[model samples]
Target chain A: MPQREGSPWRGLNVVFFRELFDHLTSVRMLVLEFLVVLFGAAVVYFAAEQIRNTTAEDPFLFLRLFAPPGQSLLSFVVVISILVPIMSIGLGFDAVNGEYNRRTMSRILSQPIYRDALLFGKFLAGLTTLTICLVTLWLLVIGFGLLRLGIPPGAEEIGRLLIFLLVTIAYAGVWLALSLLLSVVFRSTATAALVALGLWLFLSLLWPALAQMLGGVISPPDIRFAQLGLPTPDTLAWQQGLSRLSPGTLYGEAVVAMLNPDAQSMTTLLAQFQGRIGSPLPLDESIVQAWPQIVSLIAGTILLYVVGYVAFQRQEVRA
Target chain B: MTDNVIEASALTKRYGRATAVDGISFTVGRGEIFGLLGPNGAGKTTTILMMLGLTDVTAGTVRVLGHDPVREPLQVKRVVGYLPDTVGFYDYMTAEDNLRYTAALIGIPLADRDKRITSALERVGLQDVGHKHVGAFSRGMRQRLGLAEILMKDVSVAILDEPTSGLDPHATSELLEMIRSLKRDGVAVLLSSHLLERVQSVCDRVALFHSGRIALLGTVPELAREVLGGGYNVEVEADGEGLALRFSEIGGVKAVDQSGPARYRLLADRDVRPQAAAAVVNAGGALRRLSVEEPSLDAIYNHYFETHGGQNAAA
Candidate 1:
C-alpha cells in the first residue's frame, strides 16, 4: 500500500459526533425508535404473562422473554429480526446520497480530512444509533420480565441475554452496512431507499422459502427418506446452508442459539433424534453452536462496509 | 515562500475519453484576485477542483503553497478554503452551528472557535443573522456565509467557484466588495465565474478559458490590446467639417468612424479624450459628449470566441 501523508481518520470524531447528533435528533429516527419500543414492550409483556402461568419450575424462564414458545411469530426476537432492518435502513439509506442531493458532498470533502473519515464516521454513527436502540429494547424486555415474573433472572440467563444482545447488534450492523452500501452505490436517495427496502423484503421474508425449493432441487431426497416421508440429510443441509446466506437468517439462527440453549446445532431435527431434549446445553456450548452464525453476520457487515468504502472513495466530489 | 501561492503547470484532467481540462497553466500570486472566466463546461470548475485536490489530476501537476495538491491534500486544504459553486449547509442548523461544525472539522480549539466564528461573521456583515437557520437564507447570504467560513479558517488561499453566479446585482456588488476585502487581508483569491462583467471589477488578472484551455490570460487592458487590436475606445460626439480627419491626425489614434450624425468613435492606443476634444474644438465643432470606454472583459471574450470559431470545440 502506498503511504498516505496523514492519518486517514483525521476528522473521524468530528464527523461521527455530528452524524450521531443528527441521527438522535431527527424526527424519522424518533418515530422508528418509538415504534420499536412499543412493539417490543407489548411482545415482552405478553410473553411474560404467558410464561408466568405456563412454566412453574423452569430454569431458563427469563430467556423465553425473547423467543417465547407457542408465539414464535410475534416474539421479541421475531419483532427485532423484522424491524431492525427497517430501522437500520432508515438511518443509512440516504447517508451518502443525501449529502450529494443536498449539495454538501463537495464542500464536506474539500475539508482537510480524507474521504475515509466521512464514510467510516457515518457507518460508526449508524451502528452507534442501532446499538442505543437495541440496548434500550433489551433493557426494557428484561425489566418487563422482572416486573411480571417476580423473580430475578439466574446468572446463566443473564449471560445468555447479554450474548443475545451482542448478536442483535451484529445483526443490526449487517443491515446498516448494506444500506450504507446502497447509499454509496445509488445517487438518488429515493432509489437507494427503495432498493434497500426491496432487498430487505426479499432476504428477510422470501429467501428462506426460495432457498428450500432450490435446495430440494439441488439435492433430491434419498429413496429411503422419501419412502419414510422424511427429508434427506443432504437436502436439509443444503436448505440450511442456502438460507443462512441471508443476514436475517444468520441473525435468527444465532439468536436462537443464544436465547434457546436447547438449540444444539444447525440441524436441530437431527440433534433431537440423539435423545437430549429439554436439557439446555452449557453457555459455552451454545456459543460454540452460534459461533459460525455470529461470525457470518459480522463478516457480512464488514464486507458490505468495505464495498461501500471503496465506492465512496472513488466517487467524484463535484456534486 | 514565494509570492505565488498557487502554481499549476501543464495541468490537464481527462474523464475517460473526454478531457475536462486540457493542458492549461497559470499562477495565482499572494493577495491577488485571479479570475477563471469561462462558459459552462469550459473546465473552470474542474480546474478549481483540481487545485483544491477535490478531484484527481490526470496528467500534469498542481501545487498550492508549494505542496503538490494531489499528494499533500491535507496540508494544502488546511491553509486553502474552498467555496463550492452552490455552497450548502445543513438546513436544520443555525448559521453559527454550521460554522461550529466546520470549525470542529478544521480542529479549531474550543476556546478559539466562538471568537473566530463571530469575527468571521462580522467581517461578512452576517453577525446579526448568525442565529438564523441557513435554510431561510437568500442565495447571496449563503455566499457570504461561505466567505465567512474561509475567513474563519484564516486561510492563506481561498478558492471560490462561481461565487456570484446566482446573486442579484446588489448582492453581487456586496460579494465583490467582500472579495476585495479578502484580498486586502493578504489572502490569495482564486474565483471562477462566467459572469465576465460582474467579476471583471474584482479580478486583478483573468484567464479566459475556452474548450478546456486558456485562450487568453492577462489583465483586461492587456487582453484587449492583444485581441481587439486596441485598448481604448474614445467616443467624440461632435458636428464639424472635416472632424473625422482632424481626430485621425492626433497621436495614437488608429481609426475613426462616424457612428451617428454628430458622433465619431475613435480607436486609440490610450485614453485620448482630451486630444480628441481639443481637435473637435480647434476644428470649430461643438463637442457634445467626449467619453472614453475602457477595455471590458465581456468585449474581449466575445471577440476572442467569435474569431476562434465560437466556443464549440469538440467535447
Candidate 2:
C-alpha cells in the first residue's frame, strides 16, 4: 500500500535505511554477531555429536539441535535465549541516547519528519537487522547438520524450523524494545546499556528462581496430598506458570515445541500419557499449541515499544 | 502572506513554581533581522523553544508560518531552520554525510539534494572539507556547517540561538557577515545573543530582555533615544577656557561642566557637533578635539537592566 503524502511515514524509509547501514557496519553488532555464531555453532556441534551417537535411523536428528541435550553442554535453545537479548540490547541500548551524545537529536528532530517516523523507523530497522542475523545462524546450523550428521530435515521439521526462527525474532523484539525504552529513560548511553543487561540477567536467570520461591511461598504444598504420597501438582503448576512469564521461558517453550514433534507439552507428563500411542502431533498442532507463547512475546514487544515511543516524543531535544 | 513570519502573543511558559517566560509577545517579519538580546536565563532560550514548539506554552498563542507549532509542528518546521547554541553534528560522519542525513530527514528528494548540498557547502566555505570527518572539525568550522544545514533546507525563517557565543573575533565577524547575506535572500532571522554590540550592528530592531520581560524594544537609535531621552553625551577639549565657555553658549547645550583642564563635558538635546565645533573655533581658542558621543547599545542595555532591578549586565 502506498503511504499518504506528507504522512508521518514520509521519513521512515530514509531513517530506516540509514540506521540499517549503521547497524550493519558497527563493530558492536559485529562482535555480538561473532559471539552468537561461535556459541551457536558450538552447541550445534554437540547436538550433532549426540545425534551421531544415537541410532542412525533417528528421524528427528536435525531437530534435536534446538532441544536440551541429555549431556551437560548448553543446548541451542538456551544459547539462543541468552544470546538474543544481548544482541538485541546491544543494537538498541544506544539508539536514542547515542543520538543525544552525538548531538544529532536536535538537528534530526528539527527536520520535516514527525517523531513517529523517527522512532518507528529505528525499531523496524533493528528488527530487520536481527532477522538477518538469526536467519544466517539458523542456516549455519542446518548446513552443519547436512554436512556432519548427513541428514536433511523433512518438510515437517522445516516447518518447525521456520516457526522457531519467527519465535526467536519475536523474543529479540521484546529485548530490543526494552533497550530502546531504557535508552529514552536514561541520559547516558552506558547507563542504559548497563541497566538493560542487568534487567536481562534478572529476567532470564534470576526471575525463574525468584518466581519458584515466590510461587512456593504463595502456594505451599498441601500436606494432606503429600502425606498421601501424591505430588502437590497445583503448586508446581502455578510455579511453572509464573516462570513462564519470562521471555526466556516463553522462547524455551516455543522453540522446544517446534523442534520436537514427539514432545506434546512443555512440562513433563508421563503419567497423563500412559495409554497414548507413539504417534506425534503434526506441525500445525504444535504451532497452535505455541500460539499463546508467540502472542505473549509480541505483546511484550509492543508494550515496551509504545512506552519508548511516548517518552521519545516528549523528550526535549536540547543538550 | 502576513509580514510577520513568526508571531507570539502573551506567550508564557512555566516550570512548576518558576516562570521561564512570562507574558512575552513579539513578531518577526519576513526579510527582517530581529534579535532577542538578553543575558543568560533572561528567558530568551525558553521563548525560542516555545516558538519552535520544542516546549509547550503555559498559556497564550504562538504561530510560525501561520501554524501553531504545537498543533502543526511539521508544517512550522518545514519552513523554519534553527541553529541552536553550540549545535552538534554526527562526529563519525563526514561533512557531506552529515548534510546527507539532514537532507534525508528534511525529505529533500534525491535528484536535487546533491546540487543543493554542494551549493550550501560552497556558500558556507566548507566545500574543501566536505569529506573530512566532523570530529576533526574546529568549533568555527562546525558552526559554519550548521549554517550549511540551515541553507540546505531552504527555509523561509532561520532561528539562531547564540550563534556566536564562543567564536573568536575573526569567526564571529565572518558569521555575522554570512547572517547578513541570509537577510539579502529574504529570509527572516530571529537570532538570540547576549552580545549587545553585535546584535545592534546586525539587527534591524531588537528586544532587550531583562528578568523574563522585554525591558526595551526598538531600532538601535530609537532604543538609545528611549533610554537616554534625547540627551547626547559630548566632550570638548581646547587650549583655553574660552572653548568651554563658548561650548556652554551653544543653542542645544543643556548642561556644561568643566570635567578636566580646558575640557568641557556637555549634555545636548540635539546634534551638538556643528554648533559646538563652530563655537570652539570662533572663540579664538585652540580646539584640540570635540566629540559628540551617540548612545551605544551597551549604555541602553545597562539603563534598561538597571531600571528593571536586574544585576548590572554590561555589554
Candidate 3:
C-alpha cells in the first residue's frame, strides 16, 4: 500500500471539507434553512411591524422592550433559542443514519479515516454553518434595531450579548450531540429525526410541567389553612432539582440568565435554601454564576457523543 | 494464511437469531481474481462484509493484509477498497464531486485528490461524464462509478461485492475488463457474483459459496476436475452395442455407456481416444465418428451443490 505521512489535523481537514460540501449542496439542508429563514422572517417582520404600527410612541418596541438602545441579549437569545435547537436537530438528526441508509457507511468505514473524523467533521461543519447563519441574523436584528432606535449597544450590553451567544451555542451543541446519538442508535434517518423531534418536544414543552406535577403528587408539602393551597418549599425544591436534570430546562435557564440576569427571582429561593445569598449579579455575571449548568450542558453533550462513538464503532455496517 | 493476502477463518456472522454467514473459511492470494460465486441470500455479501470489517464476526478471525479487520480496521481499510453490492452515491453531486468526496473521506491529500479522481474516472471510462450528476446516471454507470471510487484510493486490494451484478452484457464485459486490468496492476481483487459467465471470464481463481462455506475452491479447470471428475469423455458412433462394450473393456476406459442407438460414451481418466478408436475398429464395429468433450466448469459447479446439500455436509 502507498503510505503518506501527514498531521492528524490533515485528516480532520479532509473530513470537514467532505461534510461541509455535502451540507452546502444537500437538498435537505437547503430545504431546512429555507424554511427556517422564511418562518423567521415572517415572525420578525409581522410581529415587529404590528407592534410598531400599534405602539406609536416607540416604533421599535421590540428592540426597546428587550434592550434599551443597545444590543438586546434578550432578543438575540430569544431568536436563537427558537432557532438553535431547530438548526441543530435539522443538521444532526440524519447525520449518521442517512449514511447508514445510503449504504455508504460500509464504504466510508472501509476508508483509512477514523470514526471520530466522520462524527466530529459533521458537527464542526454544522457548527460553522450555524455560526454563520446566527451571526447574520444577529447583524440583521441589530441593524434593524439601530435603524429604528438609532443607538448602539453599550459595553455591558455587548458583553451580555456575547455571553448569550456562547450559551446559546452550548445549548445547540447539546442537541447536536443528542441527535448524533439518535442517529447511531436508529438505522433509519427518518426514525432518528422523529425520535430527536420527540425528545425536543418532551424536554422543551412537556417535561418541566410533568416534573412539577410529579413533585406535587409525590410529596405534597403542608400549607397554611388561612389561604388557598399553594406550592410548598419542599415541593418547590424538588421541582427545581428535577427540572435541572432536563437538558431543555438547563439550556433555557442558562440562556435566560445570560440574556437577562433578573429574568427570574432566584435570590429568594437561594436565600431560603442556602441561607446566605448575595445580591443578584448582572446578566454576564449570572452566566458565570450558572457555570455548573453550562458545564452540565457541555458534559452531557460530550457524554452522549462518546456513547454514540462507541455504538457506531460496534455497529456492523455490512447491513 | 501464509500466501493469502486475506484469510477468513471459520467466519460466522449472526444477526440476533438469524444466521447471515455460517462458519466459512477461505483465503485470497496476491494478484488473484477470486470470485465468490453464489446466489442472492447465499451469504456472499455477508462474507465480503466480514472480510472488509464492515460487519462484526460472530465467531471467527479475519486477517486482511496481515492485520485483523475487526481490531485493526483502519490498517486493513487503508489497503483495501470496498465496492458494496449496491453502490449508493450522493445523488445531488456530480460524478467528480462524488469521487472527490470519497477520496477525501479515504484521507487522500487535497493535491493528490484531483489526480486520483481524474485517473480513477478515466480508468472506469467515465472521464467525459465526470461533471454529470450521478442522479442522471444509469444503473450500469453507477456501478462503474462505484468501481472508480474504490480505484481512486490506489489501494492494494479491491473487495467488490457483486461488481457486475446489474450490468448489461456490454457493461458486464467492460467491468470484467476493468477487473482483469486490476490483475495487471498487481492488485488482488475479491468479487462475488452469480453470473457464471462473468466469473468465468474474469476470475483467475474462484470459490463456489454454498451455505456460507467454500464448497468448491480452485481455478476453473481445477474446480472442473473436482466437480466433473477431471477427464475427457470419448464419444464413438459404433455399428453395434456389443462392439461398443468390447471397446469399453479396453484397458484405458473407466466406464462405457450407450448414449444413443449408434453412439457410445467412454469415460476415461486420460486421453484414450486413439485406443478406444482402434479397439472399436478392431472389434468389428464401424467407427463412424469420434469426438472428445472436456468437462465444463458449470457441470462441476452443479455437482458441488449436489454433493454438498447444506452446511450439514461437514458433520
Candidate 4:
C-alpha cells in the first residue's frame, strides 16, 4: 500500500496486512476455524433432530423449553461466550513478547512505525478474526433455524441478533485488550499465555460460583437476617442482586433480556419468553428493565480494555 | 574530515547500580571505516545499542546524520542499518524470504524489492545459498545473511558489533573484505571487533575503548608514530665498532645495542640511515642487513591494559 506522509500511523497498514496475512495463512487458525464450525453445526443438527422427534406436536414450545420461544439463539450465544475468549487469548498473548523473543521487535521498532501502530494493529487483527468467526457462526445458526422452523427470522429477531453480536464484540474486545496487555507485561510467551488463560477461566467459569460463595459467607442461608433470609420474602431478591455482581452472570442476564423482550416478570425471565411481533414493545422498555446489567457489561468491557491499552502503552519492549 | 557521519557526546547508560555505557564520546567521519576496538564487556555492545536507540541513554545525547537519536529515532534509524553481535533470524524462512521480509518491513518499494534482494545477497557472496533455509546455514552463512539484510537498506551508516565473532579465518577475511567494500561505496561503518590486525589493515582510524570511554583515537599510522618513534638496525660483518663510534658522535643517534658479531640495532629520532650507511662504508664494512621496526596493534593493546590496569581493561 501507499505510505501516508506526515503520519505516525503510516506503517500501521503494514502491521495490519502482515498480521492479517499470517493469521489467514496459519494452519492453526484454519484448523481451529474448521473444527469449531463443524462441531457447532453437528451439535445444532442433532439438537434440531432430537427436538423434531420428541416435540413434533409443538416445536415452538419445545424450543422454548430448551431456548426462548421461536429462537434457538441461546445455543449461538453460549457458543460465542465459550469460543470468543479462546480466540481472543489464542490470537494475542504472544503478539508483543513473541516479537521480542524472536528478535524481530528490533527490526520492527527500527522501522518508521510507532509502537502505537504495532499495538493497535494487533488489537484490530484479533478483533477482526473473532468477528469473522462470530459471523460465520451466526450464518450457520440462522440457516439451521430456518431449516427447522421453515421460516426466516423477521426484522425484530434480526435486530436482536445484531445487538447480541455488538455486545459479543465488546466482550471479545475486553479479552483481546487483556491478552495484549499481558503479552507486554510478561517477558515470556508461556507466562503471558498462562495469565490470559487464567483470567478467562476466572471470568467465564468460576466468577459466578465465587460470587455465590461470597454471598453465602456474607449472608448465610441458615442465618435469620432481619430483612433478607431464606424464610423471608426478600431472600430471593437479595440472592439475585448479589449474583449480578459477577460479570458472567451480568452478561448472561443482558443476553436473556435482549433475546426475550416479553419475559418481564423475574420468574418468567428464566421460564422462557412467549411473544409475537408487530405489536412491538418500545426498545427502552426492555433496555430500561435490563439497563443495570447490560450497562454493567458494556462498562466493564470498556473499562477493562482501557486499562489494558494504558498498561500496554507504558510497557518496555526490552526483554 | 568535514563530513561527520556519527557523533556521540558523553552518552551514558545505567541499569540501576550498574553503568553499562559510561560517558563515551566519539565521532565517525564520512566513508571512514572506524573500528571500536575493545575486549568483551567493554561496553561495545551497549554503546552500539544506545547509538541505535535500542536502549535508553541515561545521560547525554547521540546524533546520527545530524538527528538526535532518542528524539528523532525514526529519522536516524531509517538511514542507519545495525547488525547486533548475535544476529538472530526467523529460522523458518529461507534466505531470500527473510531478506524480502525485512525489505517489506522497512517499506521497500514492491517494484524494486526483488532487484535489491538479489543484489544484496550477491554482494555478501550468498547468491548460491539464497534458496536455503537460514536455520540450516552455518554461522558464517548467517553472518553473511545478516550483512545482506542491512545492505538492502543502502543506508548512510552501518553499525556492526562483532561481525566476525564466530567466523573462521577465511570467513573473517570474507567479512572484513565486505566491510572494506562498504567503505569504498562511501558507507560509513562503525564496527566493534577483537580482530586487531584486521582493524589495523582495513580501518583508516580506530578508538581503543576501555571502561566505556575511548582510551585512544586516531589513525593506525598516527598511533604508531605516537607510541613508537623511528628506529632502525644495521648488521655489518666488519667496521661496525667504528660505525657505532661515528653514529654516537652524530646528534640523531640515540642508543645502540650489539647482540652478535655482525649484528647491531640502533635507536634514533630521525633518518640517520644515510649517515650510518656512509659511516659503515667509510670504515670499510659491508652492510649485511638493515631493517626498521614499528609498533603493532597488539603492542598498543598491551600498552592500553598496562596503563589502564586490568580492572578497566575489559570495561
Candidate ordering by lDDT (highest first): 1, 2, 3, 4
What does candidate 3's lDDT look like per residue over B175-294, in tens digits?
A: 889889988998999998887765776788888776666677888766765566645678888684476668667775677888888888887656678887778777777778989876
lDDT (C-alpha) at residue A176 in model 3: 86
Compared with the true structure, what per-residue lDDT tens digits does model 2 show for residues B168-227?
999999999999999999999999999987657799989988777777888876776677
Q: What are the clashing pairs of model 2?
A: none
- Model 3, A217-289: lDDT tens digits are 8767666622565667788878888887778788767755655454445545554575544433555557666
What does candidate 1's lDDT look like per residue over A166-253, in tens digits? 9999999999999999999999999999999999999988999999999999998899998998889999989999999999889988
For candidate 2, what is the DockQ? 0.49
Q: Candidate 3 i-RMS (Å)?
A: 5.6
Q: Write the per-residue lDDT of candidate 4 for residues A1-319, one digit (tens) a residue.
A: 1242335575777777768767777776887687668766765666666666666554133222224344444364566567677777888889888888876676666655667678787778778887887777777777777778665566656766777666677777767777888888888999999988887788667777766666666655655554462243344456667777655566677666666665554434333454433233445565665677767776866676666667765555443
Candidate 1's displacement at residue A40, Å, is 0.8
lDDT of 4 by residue, B206-309 (tens): 88877677777887656654554433333333444566677677665667776667666666655566777777887778876666554467677776567667
TM-score of 4: 0.80
Task: Give DockQ per model, in order.
Answer: 0.75, 0.49, 0.45, 0.31
**Model 2 spans > 4 angstroms off:** A1-6, A228-233, A265-279, B230-242, B245-257, B264-294, B310-315
| Residue A280 shift from truth in candidate 3, angstroms | 7.0
**Ranking 1 against 4 by lDDT, winner:** 1
Q: Which model scores highest in TM-score?
A: 1
Question: Highest lDDT among the candidates is held by which one?
Answer: 1
